[model samples]
Target: MPMPASYPTYVPRKQFTQYLDDYVSHFKISPRYHRSVESANYDEGTRKWYVKVRNVSSDEIEEYHGRFLVVATGETTDAFIPEVEGLNSFTGEVLHTTQVQIGKGI
Candidate 1:
């Protein structure tokens, strides 16, 4: 489905999340959220990926086996600020892309 014309060229995070939720619901995709991966290893003998995940809320650990494993680290998971010569000398404010909030401009 095409996005609405009211959406801007660059959709906001909340809008994008809602779109993803709608797509998941429409496709009947069951994705796990708020789970921390403790370990992921591929067994050569079984030829399968074994993943150990812990639920953040319940602190329960579960093991899952899959033929294919996809690791998706979000774009803004880590903020990187390159070290430039004389960058500290500037008195102006410096902000990273991850630190910028919607509707707030520097």
Candidate 2:
């Protein structure tokens, strides 16, 4: 995750990265590191999504498939992360439904 250095008071960046590595390992989520996703398409017959990915180092393009996809394309200038001190203890999960939309090419 080529994210530049960030240091939060509660956890050092290295320790945070270690935790991230452990979590990804435990979940069996093998991230396609150092790759750029050019586009994605869904196969209606197979009900799976295929993505065109390019290796940042060699510029080789390859296709990958998955049943579901989570598109977290980094920059979130419009995304807001509000700081509500006691919000964490309140519930299981909080979703702002109004901010979500479900559709093709959305």
Strongest candidate by TM-score? 2
lDDT of 1 by residue, 1-106 (tens): 4555687889898988887777678669789889999987767678777889999999999899986665555575587766644447644355666776533433
TM-score of 2: 0.53
Q: Candidate 1's error at 71, in angstroms?
A: 2.5
Encode model 2's per-residue lDDT on 1-100: one tens digit a residue: 3222463546676877776776677669777788898887666688777889999999999888987655564555466545444446533244442365
> Candidate 1: where are CA atoms >4 Å away?
1-8, 44-47, 77-106
TM-score per candidate, in order?
A: 0.50, 0.53
Looking at model 1, residue 34 earns an lDDT score of 91
Span of ten consecutive residues with least summed lDDT in model 2: 97-106
